[model samples]
Target chain A: MKNLNEISTRLEIAKKKIKKNQIKDNGTNAASLGKALKISTELVASVVVGSTIGFLLDNWFDTKPLLTICFFILGVVAGILNVIRSAKKMHKINKYRKR
Target chain B: MSLNPMHQFEVYRLGPEINLGSINLSFTNASLFMTISASVILFFLFIGTKKKSLIPSKIQLVSEMSYSFVAKMINDTAGSSAKPFFPFIFTLFMFVLFCNMVGMLPYSFTVTSHIIVTFVLASIVFVGVTIIGFIKHGLKYLELFVPKGVPVILLPLIVIIEIISYLSRPVSLSVRLFANMMAGHTMLKVFGGFVISLGLLGGWLPLGFSVALTGLEILVAFLQAYVFAILTCIYLNDALNLHH
Candidate 1:
């Protein structure tokens, strides 16, 4: 019984250690997830906003689809800009973490 | 009664339906779940923080961890400038987290699954951040649409690009949360229906997948909440610090 108790206590301590490591891993994982999701959403959102604004402007100015087309192109560019900016932000965070 | 995956998202009126003006102001399952989630958060926090013992109980530990987690997140993302907005951000995080979590329970409505709901939340943050920026910097807040260190010739193009990106914040934020919750729950329900349809021997495979999917969805629920809060902090950082 004494030996069994010692082994169980050892097991419990080991389990606790593993749990701590897992928690650390999860923190890093969540951070990376936040980065990845932010980039994707930023990409889509810029385009959507760009196109909507352009379309509305075209309607108001009686320009038909001209402004819409121009804005859509601009939106794509903006989306890429967003992705780059978010990537840079993430990179900066990683550098800070290292220090 | 039918094993339809889409049925889970249907908004049904609960109790007396009230109409004010031309708008339908009926209490819905969505509203009920929202109330439930809010109450659950309050109840949990109330009970958890009640015991301030030195040797902390389980509830106290959870409460403390959540407090520290949001505190740390705000500090890391927004720095000291966002100290004033801590309560609002914390409440947003907890509300969304609870809504996502409570929805994971069977037969519960997922309030975050609706685009309108998430969009409203996102819009509030967007408008609030914009207002803060203007209040802090006056007309200079428009400077946010212009990134630092761009060549003179590229100023107009870059400004437009930045403005477009700025306008997209709420759209992306709301859609990301709404789509993630809706997609995960729908997939879970679909797989669940398959498990039921294919009984005994055949059902085992789908049952296993459903189990795995549930685990993934739970992670997603937490991650989406984190993403929402962190993004808000980042936006707050921009408004507060004017980081280009």
Candidate 2:
């Protein structure tokens, strides 16, 4: 509920405390914070969907070798799909907000 | 040996290249794109929350949450002295959050996964803090390396160690974020690749792992962003307290 200025002011104080203690990045928090967290379900779906296409392509080309190519392309498509899905989610969330 | 995992850090060409200087800036690498993604998110957040009225909406709620979260962290860890530095801290949070979150996307780049991006942010903190320290304390800022209450004999040695450690903050700060992001993403990528290569015979296990891993990665994205911002808060505490 604090104003932006008040919030920023508190952060400045915290920054100083960190410096004085020689606060290293090690274990500042409970566990190491990393990208392993915050992954979306859509991302997992993307890869699965990509793999399905690749599996089908491998079957279609009458050669399993094409699976490799199909999978590679699928990966890119999946990445793009992730972006689209994320954008849609953001938009949806925005729509949900009122007032 | 195979290419260093770090070698994957270079920028590449994607579309018609444009020359800004001696270097061509076209197909930017994962790092550059992550930076752009962060900026885009910031832009939208700004647009969404810019409006102020009798009622607040979803974007406003998020914006408010982000603002208060940092503020509370600062108050709890560093106190009121952190006020002036909120903007920098906010930017850091957004940037790290974006990088970590975007990296969770399939095959998308994780800029924070590299040391360079994290280093840039850390360095800014270092330079900013150092300047602020000196500005506030003037010549007295030198006292930060020498703590009170230590035994007389150990004073000199302790002071030396403190200075060395103080100087290393930038490297440590940068590495913590970078290593976490990089290691997590690499594991995800490897597991993801396997989920495909193993065929149906072995695919089930890796697919299951991928789902769990993806869920974990999302949590991490928020965590890293919070950690990075909170650390910045801690740093601000030192400057204000002048306890050293």
- On TM-score, the leading prediction is 1
lDDT of 2: 0.68
Per-residue lDDT of candidate 1, residues B138-239 (tens digit): 999998987788899999988888888888999999999999999999999989999898988799998999999999899999999999999999999999
> Against the true structure, what is model 2's DockQ?
0.03
DockQ of each: 0.64, 0.03
Q: Cα lDDT of model 1 overall?
A: 0.91
Chain A TM-scores of all predicted models: 0.73, 0.40
Worst 10 residues of 2 chain A by lDDT: A32-41
Q: Give the TM-score (vs. native) of candidate 1.
A: 0.92
What class would a CAPRI assessor give candidate 1's docking? medium
Give all candidates' CA lDDT scores.
Answer: 0.91, 0.68
lDDT winner: 1
